[model samples]
Target chain A: MSEDPGSPKPIVTFLGPVASYTHQATLDAFSSSDFTLTPVVTIDDVFASVQSGTSHRGVVPFENSSNGSVVFTLDLFADLQHKYPDIIVCGESYIAVQHCLLGHPDSHHASHPISVSERTGGSRVGSGVIESPLSSGAVTPTSAIPNPQKPTARPVGDLARIKKLYSHPQAWGQCKIFLNAYLKGVERQDVSSTSRAAQLVAEDLTGESAAVSSVIAAKIHGLEVLARGIEDRGDNTTRFFVIRKRAEAEVGDATSVDRKEIGKDEQGEGDWKTLVSFTIDHANPGSLAHSLAVFEKYGLNLTSINTRPSGVENWNYIFFVELKGRREEGIEDGPVNKALKSLYGVCRSWRWLGSWENRLAR
Target chain B: MSEDPGSPKPIVTFLGPVASYTHQATLDAFSSSDFTLTPVVTIDDVFASVQSGTSHRGVVPFENSSNGSVVFTLDLFADLQHKYPDIIVCGESYIAVQHCLLGHPDSHHASHPISVSERTGGSRVGSGVIESPLSSGAVTPTSAIPNPQKPTARPVGDLARIKKLYSHPQAWGQCKIFLNAYLKGVERQDVSSTSRAAQLVAEDLTGESAAVSSVIAAKIHGLEVLARGIEDRGDNTTRFFVIRKRAEAEVGDATSVDRKEIGKDEQGEGDWKTLVSFTIDHANPGSLAHSLAVFEKYGLNLTSINTRPSGVENWNYIFFVELKGRREEGIEDGPVNKALKSLYGVCRSWRWLGSWENRLAR
Candidate 1:
């Protein structure tokens, strides 16, 4: 997947300081060697990077299976559409999120010496174990560096010794079952991202703090993983969108972007989805119903529907709807085009967020 | 509003350690002298208190004007309906959330002497300010207690001197404009609640830390307010529900419970609302459209709709719908009853969370 020496590799930016779930998704969707990956501080930064043309592409977490929609991402889409109409979701990928209880290696209780080698069976920290290429390559050198003095056995910690637990708020909610059983009453602090929590624990080696983060984060920050897969559900997955600005020629090409050929069925049909957002007349009782009926009328399948406060007024909302069809397919008389045309007639305002190949099954 | 000497005051529990926005809402809805208000650690605890009949009522935040839905409250309602079907939303109250920059009096930088007198005009530290009764009464005695030694001028803090800012995640979002403008690069830490953030800052007293919380929190914790109304919007508000367990005879009695009669309009027709959650067949693309159509067919106005992961399977979701009618008023050939009957026919599973007197205008 590495690019030729003469070719200028496209830069891909994602929400991160590195080792975040978004970073993992970015790696999954694009080959690191083929693209120069950069980490931005916030989700807004990811959008700004793509919008400003500083980065050729960007990735962001759209939703978590357990936590439902990421309101920040949805709200940003609504705001960015008007400002940067050419920005579109080019592709998407899912990463299975497994949260681990991570602590500063020095903070482990002396009574329980748990070495990194013992946990991974000496497979080298984060090497081929977490399915993240960045974590494996980034942490291998750090783990190989020998201490000047002989290293003492690293201590393993429990809830009793951990005075503080840091993680993204979503991670805390995902691991509620484990937290309630073991770390009940522990002070949980939320950080901007899970990797930031790990970085903080590493920086403040008080030996009294732990972070709920990904194994990749623990490896990148040289923290020890005390427990793995701590989320309440085993099937915890987060879907991320790989977005990019449309080309100059593609400015008004809402239904003409070339669809990527991947995950095709035997019938030679590739699954695809389109995202759109719009506002309706708040005074009409059945305005939402009338708007949604256009999909049914056009024989289009609606995958998801979410409502967010418009922030303009109380009880006023904007709806984000995902439909199961590509914008380009069967155009001129396609179900998606027909449904969208009828939708514009009913909605007060509307915008096409993007259309991309669908990855998640119905 | 005080109860008779012989009468036992009803116990009211809310999500709190006191000085929380929920506490303010509880006070606004019920007279403190008439009801013995208690602080519970979590929203779940508040629900448990009401479900177990340990408290006459419980108060929990329903939504924030800026951040939109409180998914925790919505998810809890979906879960609690099956276990305690009799528990209902009896009433509601709104609290205007004004976030204050609270810090330890001694932590201010030496160069900037920001006295409480200078910022609040010697207003007795949250005294007669901020509409919350809890702030006025609970902190008055402490604020009145003068130090034996003459007080030195407390130094005011700027963004550069503060090393960390603590607040609820919602507060961080609410005060984004202020934070981005003044404290661009300061480390932001998320606590359980706004008041809890104040408590932590008060406990640490490092002089380099601050909290974004209510004026009530600052007063109770003896912290000085460096600034007030720091939220992005002036009309920032959070709505809370006053919930109670219904009696056996009142199980089906949606109306006719003793109405508290606070904030009632002169017309005597109290607006009513009902909340219900249902899941539909994921394979059926138009199932949700069909289910929502039931509301339009029966003329029930939907004020809000939110989607949450059912948590049982991937791509499966439960829809929470808030409509403008009470269960009893539109039952027995009413629109609400007819709409619900049709909804049940289309959904895979459904539960009636509760119906309460509507407080927020459409």
Candidate 2:
């Protein structure tokens, strides 16, 4: 498809007020110069924007390394596909999560030193260094009060001074170790997004409040990073998907094929993953297992499997299966097709969510 | 087992600050007269209480009809079973969720009529009738202001006056229809539990605040139910599990057996279910499907299946499966046992969570 020179750049909507992980993922996938990045209030808005044709693409989180799948996104994929059939998963990217303790920069107590007597055992009680990528390897203590009497004991910033901690629920789980050790009994207020948490703390200008967010969010909101890399796990990461409307083939390109056949020629190269969701008859024993057997018969690799309640009745579920192949040549025809055809006969219902190049290979 | 005449009543701990759904479920499972019901701060606390032998039994929510499985509880089950092997599931129960809008009774504008012009289209409009089981088959309009000019139109309690909507995140989802309708842009503050939300609203005595919780919770917190049965769906229900320490057989009981043979006599009766968790070799194609086939071979019906990341690596997951049968009779000697033995040979790891009499059959 050729772009008109004068036409406005395509808008990419993502889950955010700004500087959220989804916003960072959107930036990683598309160049800011080529596309206008817009932040919406919720994940539903991201899908709605693409479905309404207001935005050309939408970015949303699919899963986290430590927390498992984002169930709401999976449920939306099941609910919205029937209406927005053209919207497909086109690309995927991963973002390393680094949670930081953010506080008001101008507050007088921002650099107050934590008393040695207050340091609980097992808590990270060393010098409270704000570890940024730009910082040197040595710990740069941010505390204003440096006790010379205890040279061996490094002074750390006082976390006890903060009465309220604002963060997304997921962030709380990620920073459980830090919260449990140092900030135990502090009031934790759950916000819609981490960026919003940073924004609240920044806007309040209260030294008494802090937020668990990213350095990017702290920077954007004009907040100070009191501590960094506070997540319980070092390998904390979130995978995001870039979704766009399915387009028809252009007339000029000789090799161009129908949208349905876009991934056919690229199949069997082992660089694609397709996601499909289906519901089986709960009354029948092994119905799900039998349907899954078809994948083995086709020599297909099942990458992931998840289940969510169908909401119709107790114990009824809709299963989402991610397979190692594309939709066209890799899955739509031959053995994969045969398995799906058989699945169609036995299962109550099923649908293909999308096929995209596997991001793990990167 | 025989109860000692002078022994203290068994203590049952559940996730609670009191008046939470788990508290309600715990009440439903055992009579207060026979058990000393205790409330804990978190789900982890409930498990800790059971493992530490501080409480004889623990109650926790397993699944919701609308929202799907509680992943935290599932993850805790996987983590705690290795440490507390003897703490097995003893029973199950279900509680119908009836969310109500609660406010302080002494507030001057507690029964103010909702302005028709204030409601945005998607929010629940028209007469807001609070449905209660005690009321006859008639709409109970609690509005203090009755507009005599519009005789046919039912005046409803004003939601616009509510400045803050406090609730558990799940409660917010369940009451979205009502929230979106009347209190369009109100600030939503997420609390630790729904009952805590009620407690906050009741304590504030501010005519400006409200909470989304159960009528029972409102009563417990000394608040008035402004509106009842406000959840979007009528079938909203949560299933809870009763857990207790394994007991050794007494000499006098004729039916007494070892813990290994606990469910043997109860099998083939079609009134029991078992929960098991296992991790399969992710590299192998259809290894999970193959393992699941053993259930079908045994003529055992699979009730539900869910997957959570094992936290080892990406694309690596631990699957939780619930089957229709007891452990000793339905699983130990016959097809279920054979299937599990085969699964043990193929799977990387597997563990039995527990077996309990099926509450659905009741």
Candidate 3:
């Protein structure tokens, strides 16, 4: 909200340690010059930083192409409408995820750093980097800077020499085919996140351990890349949401409703997406079907849907539904607003999570 | 499929290490005297045993109320219709989950094992046991028996005495409230599962660690339940499905179709639940909404719905839909058969995972 010329750059927090896919998303969401970026350890911390007004914006991984919903993020939205009155999703970013096997620069061997293209079926991982976004003075001296351990040891041997592999639990599954083939008997040790995995490898005095992390992480942590694009699929990607506080009256909905002024694209491709989650009388027949049909009545195309436990009872679920609305217009002027308005009558309880520009660029 | 009175009791494989929740679910699914129980470390192994015909049946945790759909299980069914033909879900079981803080019984406080009912807000844990299910001749001599490390240490102090806490990643979230209030700042070390956490505690000779595990695991590992019923919710439960290979053609669906042979109950109560997953043309605006509408056409009540990455491509999801059908009717005789029959026309591609009696027993 404070992008005025010469205004102090507002801090944008993300789930990170400077090299996670989420960090990649933060750089993509707001131009580096517009805000000062910082890292938080968890998704909850990202939201808390924004919720408490400690951070101006927050970027969180909403879902992954292969792993499905980041339920932890979704679970945080349960009763979020009342819990955090101002935070709302403002934009989204897509990160092309390519995991690489990283190791201590001193422990791993390659004679020299080689581009992946030199190997069979390998592609060059863009030495993705963020030049001084965090190191810049835009961040206050009080802020903790990421000061990674510099590698001082000499080079060692190949994959066969590695005894233990450190990785976030999710990475192991995504890179299973490669792990089973090349590092079959290597011991896997799970860390909390990919950033942590890389950090662990950087700190490993053993030189016998490695990790699966982003190429950026390898660079940030001063580790050497041992293998590139190890994930099962070449097109693996993660989607994220950029959030900031929204003042209610600034919403311009409720009182002065704009009926039928949807801007530009009528087709689904460029339409904005609105996400809302709710619970219904699951015991009653046709409740969910009827709830879904409401999207059809108002001509809102349903794009994605998911379910999570509501926490109140066993088997009772809360459903998250996303729908596409014409982009150029205010949501109040499109089927999204009308459909959400009607859900009050249809759902047992509901919360409008957020609406954001459909910036799903690959 | 071979539970003949004189036949070698068929091996029923489950995801486990003796006293995990899946082990509990296995005990509930099959009468111990009728089958030999075995433990496989991963969910994939549970399915693998059944698919390779190495085991007679398999039991896998399907979903947990607090944790939602076990995506691993859901993803396993993506191409299951053809990949593992005949391995159909036949029965279901519910396991009430209550995680306890367990430590080496010798290094634990409390001169005696006190019932949880003695604590401020505690209740008695059932001390669930599967007396020698794994040890009796029910299992083959070659099967690896759970031989826990005998704790030769002696009693220590209270929660403050815990130097480190061990738990499965999921258990950490479920007991956050209790952990924060009592064991704040204790180092948490994650294990593969709750059972592994218990086993590690049993093996700890230093007597400085504790684990969040099931009461049965505490008993089986010769550990003390330092604190019981520690999960945030009292009624936390996990639902599981039992699968076995059915001889083709034994399925009475196609030829003599039970089209009109509806069972006694037409109401939702006591109705059987059918689960199916399908993909729709995501690019088409109304494809998903229309696919869901098909269920309404057949008047089937969708009891549950979940979406997982189809894995064929990014964001192309496979939806798992469960609907209720009359108990006394064959799936072919009720709306489930009719709805699934219609899905082929509505969805881009579909797979019938399995159907079983709706056993949402608390």
Candidate 4:
């Protein structure tokens, strides 16, 4: 859906430095739209852009592969709700964080170059005919490159050539098996970020180092795939929420703001899910159980329920419950509205956070 | 309790510098013990130290004030369960993170030095009689220092003397109002950690720079207090779990393992809280609700509940439920034992993570 050429293109911002995973997700979310993509330094800035009407939409990480909730983002919602009450989630998109070992273009590759795409079930890397290394088959290492001056075979002895491995400290644990099995004792240098590791490798084209970074970073920084899918564990996929300001929210024009219809697209009624956060009288042991039952009573199956500490007090928590609902119906007539009304009695405080397309079910 | 002087002190490790909040909490947990307090570079190392028996006990962050679950710590439990199956949580402790504006002993203080202890109601800074800034009172700046060279009153004009402020990037947002009101034009430098910030100011001793760091850091680095409780929002109190290796568990003699008695102390049965994680068949909409209901039926009050992505699949999650229970009795005779057996019927898989003292109730 491209907008009118004459109209100012709606700005979309994400936690950036172009080839970061969040940037990759932002590009995929607005691939066909006429929106202009901008990079923000922090997630808080991404929310601020939408909240201030500087951007029509913002993409911020909602969940991590290993961590169900992106606490940084959730905490922002709790902290900034007062500053920007109209900020709401419109849609969500997921990006698989399949880390790859990148190298300078002239660097050597692994002996058996399994097709990264094939092993990862055709990730953003797209289709490849080569088989996985686990199945007793491997693609030629030269086939991994788009252009090759030296299309020689992957010398098994090349392990000695990699004098140093570069990656963010967080990546080291994920690739322990690989590091032990292949590059044992190779000097490892910790960089600030995975993308930064790739940039370093690209800049210093000595072909003596490799970085564990994203495929997008390799492509953006002119690095070659040394060995794909270097991460031996914690196969992570991050989900991001595309958010925007409710129309006319700044002027306090409540009549023009459609609360229930937020971020609704061509998806069917069954595809939409609404997320709400509430705090119960935690001193009362039964309050939380009673609140969960209310959602079940309305036949609103909670797809996900998580808790974040309400910063107002040390141990007090705000429970985030997401459930299927129809967004077409107005807030007053919607089943979510009715369930929330019942849920409120058991809650000390509550807020309807947002509604978005349920990627989990899809 | 003092151990035998002849015996080696039980080594306890934490994520640290000598004065990080984690270090502060670790000291508090073993205040009177004949234990060695060692510092580790990463949380994973802290876990590994206990798992490998390098440390008798390890203190790691379990929950953040704004995030109910410490994702890094929780994800480690999920990732390393098989490696350290007998690693059990022994106890927990809480530390209030009261950010202080620290400076070299010779640096200038704020105009109105309100008593931090009075305002925060006795953080680890302990008791002081000066009323809070809100209560319209000020303590002479020199009184804040142990051996003041100058006992003169705080000059509001001294705000212009601050050429730069150092802090971890995370602290800037927490103290926005204070920064805006006083140090608006000061050059802010981002350091690696809050403790490091205090060190910078201490080593420089320029009196023209200050740091936003923990009070503990100020004491450790010999920095004088300039202002206290600078964080205007998101009053964060982190909870830490003190973990230890279960005795003789690497032998895999399950029969000899007494799970319920893993971490019994002077605390009564009513003070204990057990945390367990499980995954349910998400295909059925009622599975989670059913799992939650089993707890209510068993009279277990769920103190906290959170979800983490299973990491095996994109949308799949493992639920963490913490409930108040008695652990003195044998596992077979305990009320939690019956509830988990009943709870497992609704789940595809489960694990009894650990039990600890619920510090929140106190």
Top model number, lDDT: 1
Show what share of the native A-B interface contacts model 2 retains.
0.51
- Model 3 DockQ (Cα-based): 0.45
B248-358, model 1: which lDDT tens digit per residue?
Answer: 655244332233434534343346788888988988867877887788788777777888898678778888888877666424676777777777788787766667766
What is the DockQ for all candidates, taken in turn? 0.44, 0.46, 0.45, 0.26
Question: Candidate 2 versus the native: TM-score?
Answer: 0.82
Candidate 2 segments exceeding 4 Å error: A1-8, A80-82, A110-156, A247-268, A329-332, B1-6, B106-155, B246-268, B329-332
Give the poorly placed runs of model 3, Cα more than 4 Å off.
A1-7, A80-82, A106-165, A181-192, A250-270, A326-333, B1-7, B80-82, B105-156, B159-166, B180-192, B250-269, B326-333
lDDT of 4 by residue, B38-156 (tens): 87766788888888888877888787664356666887777535776657677788877777778754223444453453333532322122323433323224335342112211311
Q: How many residue pairs clash in all the candidates, one count each? A: 4, 4, 5, 0
lDDT of 1 by residue, A1-362 (tens): 22245757777898897999999888877676667788888888888888888787889999999898888888888783355666788778899998887875432334454443443342322211222122222211223323311221121233345668888888978887666655666666777799999998888767678888988998799887766677877788999998888766542332322222123233423577889888888787677778877787876777788887787876588989888886664455777777777887887888777777677754
Residue-by-residue lDDT tens digits, candidate 2, A127-213:
222322221222233544243122122214445456688898778877766666567667677787899999999877557788999
Model 3 residue pairs with clashes: A263-A328, A263-A329, B106-B154, B106-B155, B107-B156
* iRMSD per prediction, in order: 1.8, 2.0, 2.0, 4.6
Instruction: State the lDDT of candidate 3 residue by residue for A160-207, as single tens digits.
Output: 446678887778777766666566656566665798889988898767
- Clash pairs detected, candidate 2: B123-B181, B124-B181, B264-B328, B264-B329
Of 1 and 4, the candidate ranking higher by TM-score: 1
Candidate 2 displacement at residue B202 in angstroms: 2.3
Give candidate 4's error at residue B46 in angstroms: 3.8
Evaluate model 3: give its TM-score. Answer: 0.78
